[model samples]
Target chain A: MLNEKEKHRYSRHLLLDKVGLQGQEKLKAAKVLVIGAGGLGCPVLLYLTAAGVGTIGIIDFDLVDETNLQRQILFSINDIGKNKALAAKHHLEQQNPYITIKAFAEKLTSKNALELVQQFDVIVDGTDNFSTRYLVNDACVITEKPLVYGSIYKFEGQVSVFNYNNGPSYRCLFPEPPKAGSVPNCSQIGVIGVLPGLIGTQQANETLKIILEIGTVLSGKLLIYDALSGNSTSINIKRSEEQIDKTKAMKPHFASFNYDAFCGIDLINTIDITELKELLKSENIQVVDVREEWEQPRINELNALIAPLDDLDDFVNQIDRNKKVVMVCQRGARSLQAILHLKKEYGFNNLINLEGGLLNWK
Target chain B: MKINVIYFGMIAEAIGKNVETLQINSIQPNTDDLTTFFIQQYPVLKNKSFKIAVNQQMATNNTVINENDEIALLPPFAGG
Candidate 1:
């Protein structure tokens, strides 16, 4: 079914025994939906487009931020402030005129996830949040679509394939989302710019394999790549019957699933920097710095107690339970952990974690 | 029993090292025991969420670990 132009365009693929003209036609017939237009999404979109996937749908509500230039290779300075999905679509169209790219410049909510994902053969998760990730996984499970998952943090990245051939889903690997704000993202802790590129390329490879039915896919394996040490580890994952049953039970009413609530991201024990500044004016309040001593740019204005996270147990008795306690760290991650420990172990309910920590303090 | 443990991502940051060897007093220790031992030794990990992989396989708390087995602690990463 390949035209003369199509044959020449995919000459390299035609030459390969694994991906000959037949496989190229399969690529042309495939439809993939990629979620998020961030780092991992950038590379996945690029490779998928170049590989001549027939129809690609991109869903992202975020605009192109100045910070994304480092790794989001689809955008340039001119694309800043534009909608990410639209910008990526324009760039990808220029990269390959033979393929079709659909851009949805809106958030993929529980209402739209099922409808949108059902149209695509594969769902690619490039999102950077627990809520969206869980939503995507559930939607894929409900729709019976394979998901190509990728995530990065600091110098490490993780890649996996979920809901493929009745294989393990993301929930099978991570049964529950980590406590909100307990894990710092790239914005909080920095990630090496190249890490996502490597992981995203692997995700693209998995997608191709799934489409071509050639090599073994990462269906029940987690690939952990550490950029710092140049080490790669593969961890085998097992399917959980309980998680599969949970997904099936929610399939009938998938529209009502509240992913944010499921991920426990709606924080009740958090105070913004502005509110903390106002609270500082009052008496009987203590601002505790839980960061390590080596952490920089101390907050002298708060007269904080340097309780450092590892040494928190030693300072627990010294903290005043009657007074309002505010825990802080470099970012909000460790502070949230400290607050959880204090509330759970010490029975201190008078504690709050700084929402954005010192990074947001003016 | 001596076991080799590896930590990844934020778990490595909290543990201060990527890999280590520990001597467990029990001849056959379960993942829950190893988790408890690590939490007691590295209190910073008490509140952090991570999954344990025994010999490159996902491990449940009840999974028994043997001597010379390789265990890894993998923390969740939401960054794309």
Candidate 2:
């Protein structure tokens, strides 16, 4: 029922024949949960709030920083150091008095992602990292909620509506995460502030359309927008049951799943001297020497295979597949490289690097 | 066969060009073939992941590439 004040509030929307009183009611009945209060999140939250969405949940653990001012329009100098979600909620509540805003100032982890996603009809992904992006996608897929996805690079942006009515998930677009450090983030790199604004508004549009059931949904489609080129193109993506089922299978162990390790982000599994000694005594573990033959003071008792870092390709066959492989080098850097290379190129999950190499291996 | 390869995002930055016409040796090269050639030219891309689109259609590694087709290489963006 549109009260007199409510009708005055959304008069523009009501003016549209397509979005008459019925669509206004649908908007008021809709529940949208936006993840992240950063660049894309700011716009998505702004529009959804202004449109009189009945309930909006904003979950962002990030604090409002001075650097975020160029884009994250929801925060200002006074709001700096405040949690983005709470700050966004405060401002958005004032924007539209008719709506309810729920703010969660916590990181979205596997343990909590599913529960939060289930509360909303549409999930908007505005996170700035692969780990959280994948987490949001998996949670949306498992909970069967439509996801309005948007990501921005320096001058380019990508927007898609994923997991809408059995459409393709993000995994169907890129099943495996790119090796960490290979792709730089917005901080490491830089993004045009307006890029996210452009992409985020599109995401907000998608969310409204999904709720209003007007126009075609962006399911199974990936939209690419170039700020510099001034062009928008979309690639047709097919729903991969394999990708969807892999995510579904993880439902049982979702809480235990480590998205950081899956994305090769900050997986630090180095064996110390004591642990190395114990593992060596346990037998059948392969200790790989990534140092060059001439670079090391050899250990007569360790019997470590000398596969230099530069020549690792030649010794790939000799590396044991089923057994544990420990990589060692002069310092710690080369061994870490060996482990990362072996893991990325050869899928050797059994390899562990020895920290500080043999520097203190007396 | 001569085909136009369009690069997007970081890939375009690494390649230093948005579009290029390359003459490939194989008559019917798949997306993998282009990937191999690019990796050989720019080893920086050897580790970075990107997806190929043939004439605006998402393509797999085995998806065949034909002459005079527009192939787009788009990398995943990690920004909001």
Please give the CA lDDT of all the candidate structures. 0.88, 0.89
Model 1 clashing residue pairs (backbone) = none
Per-prediction DockQ comes to 0.64, 0.70
TM-score of chain A of each: 0.74, 0.78
Tens digit of lDDT per residue, candidate 1, span A1-362?
Answer: 78999899999999999999999999999999999999999999999999999999999999998999988989999999999999999999999999999999999998899999999999999998988998899899888899999999988999999999989999898878888789878877777888889999999999999999898999899999889889999999988988878787677556755576566654447888888888998766998999988787787888998999888989976776667888889889999888766653344556788977797666
Backbone clashes for every candidate come to: 0, 0
State every prediction's TM-score relative to the real structure.
0.79, 0.82
Residue lDDT tens for model 2, A10-98: 99999998788999999999999999999999999999999888999999998999999998898899999999999999999889989
For candidate 1 chain A, the 10 contiguous residues with the lowest summed lDDT are: A340-349
TM-score for candidate 2:
0.82
Cα lDDT tens digits for candidate 1, B1-80: 99998999888988789999988898778999888988988999999999899999998547999989999999988898
Any runs in candidate 2 off by more than 4 Å, and if so which? A272-362
- Model 1: per-residue Cα lDDT at residue A42: 95
